[model samples]
Target: MEFGVSTFITDEGIGAADLGRALEERDFDALFIAEHTHIPASRETPYPGGGELPRIYYRTLDPFVALTAVAAVTERLVVATGIALVIERDPITTAKEVASLDLISGGRMVFGVGAGWNREEMRNHGTDPATRGALMDERIRAMREIWTAETAEFHGEYVDFDPIYAWPKPVQQPHPPIYVGGESERAIARVAEYGGGWLPRGNVENLGDLVAKVRDRAGWRVPVTVYAARRDPAVIESYAAAGVDRTLFFLPTQPRDETLRTLDEFTELAKRHT
Candidate 1:
């Protein structure tokens, strides 16, 4: 199985280019960055991890911009968005950014996306929290159209556009692989319907069963990538046995020395499994 690392790229963390080079040097498969345009100040939305929100959430660099810097420095490392908040983005512009990054990176972009969880955050983007799922679906479909077609157009309840030409088509044949993120049934269904793979959050109890469900729904082999997987050799082996295609461990956004040390530890874990 491929091994990767995901982290919240913040201003105080290791620089993107530096981190990318480091990961590649360590022989890691990918570097996935988390994205949040801006965090709402209100504390209405509880943190997913069930604690005070981490400081990195508010200080994250734009994933596309950060990943571009990563791609510039790395030759083989897959640069990805661990979970880009598509609900807050313009599909047309996001499509171009994905394509441009893919082209410039020699087709090494993985477009991992989600509907997002923060209600007030979605509101800031003029998106209704209740309908964000449907909106995300339409936006993804619309972006796929923009990526593949010479003259693309899409009309839906949430996304409507006329045929227009966008250049710098992705180097990957159709487009970069879209990995739908989340662990819910709806998220799995979305993966079956439109995504190239599934990006499930880590520490699932019955991961093999989940992988089977996704494959059954998709009627094909759907790649399953476990995000935030624990950096344990046995855990990695368990995931591999459960048919995981990749396992991305979480890297704390910290100082360069500390971050590299964590990577070194994870690299040792990877060696034991590989």
Candidate 2:
């Protein structure tokens, strides 16, 4: 399995270009960054990890801008959105941003997407929490249309548009690869329908079985990438043995020196599996 790093590239952490170069120098295959447009103060959405939300949740750099910087600085590292919240974004603008990033990066973009957990955050974006999944599905389909069609248009329940022109189609034909992020049956179904890969968190139950379930439901060999944020080498080895295509280790949000040290630690751990 290939190895990479994923993190909330925050304002306080290592800068994108420097971090990207360091990751490339360490032989990491990719750098996936997370995003959150804004955090609402009056929030009842408990974090998925079960505690107060981390400071990094509200402090991430815009994934496209950061990943673009990463792509500019590195030749081999794939710059990716670990889970760009499609539910909270406009499909047309997002589609253009993605295509432009893919073009600028010379085809090095992995569009990992998810319907997020923060209800308040989505609500602040004018997204109804109850119907966000359906909305996200429509948005993704619409984005696909925008990426591929010459006079792109989508008429869907949530996303609608007329035939419109979009420029700089991605270097990767038909658009960059998409990996759906979530640990739900609905997410698996989405993968079966449209995703090029699956991005499941590493700490889930019976991962081998879950991977099998996704592949079985898809009726094809879908590439599996575990977002192994727990930073445990043994579990990552288990993921590898279970036939995961790639595993991304968590890199903490810290200053450049601390970030580099963590990268070195992750690099050492990755050597066991990569």
**Candidate with maximal TM-score:** 1
lDDT tens digits, residue span 83-191, model 2: 9999999999999999999999999999999999899999999999999999999999999998898999889889988999998788998899999998898999999
In candidate 1, which residue ranges exceed 4 Å CA deviation? none
Return the lDDT, model 2, position 147: 89
What overall lDDT goes with each candidate model? 0.92, 0.90
Pick the lDDT winner. Answer: 1
Candidate 1 colliding pairs: none
Clash count list over all predictions: 0, 0
Q: Which ten residues in a row have the lowest lDDT in candidate 1?
A: 229-238
Q: Candidates' TM-scores? A: 0.98, 0.97
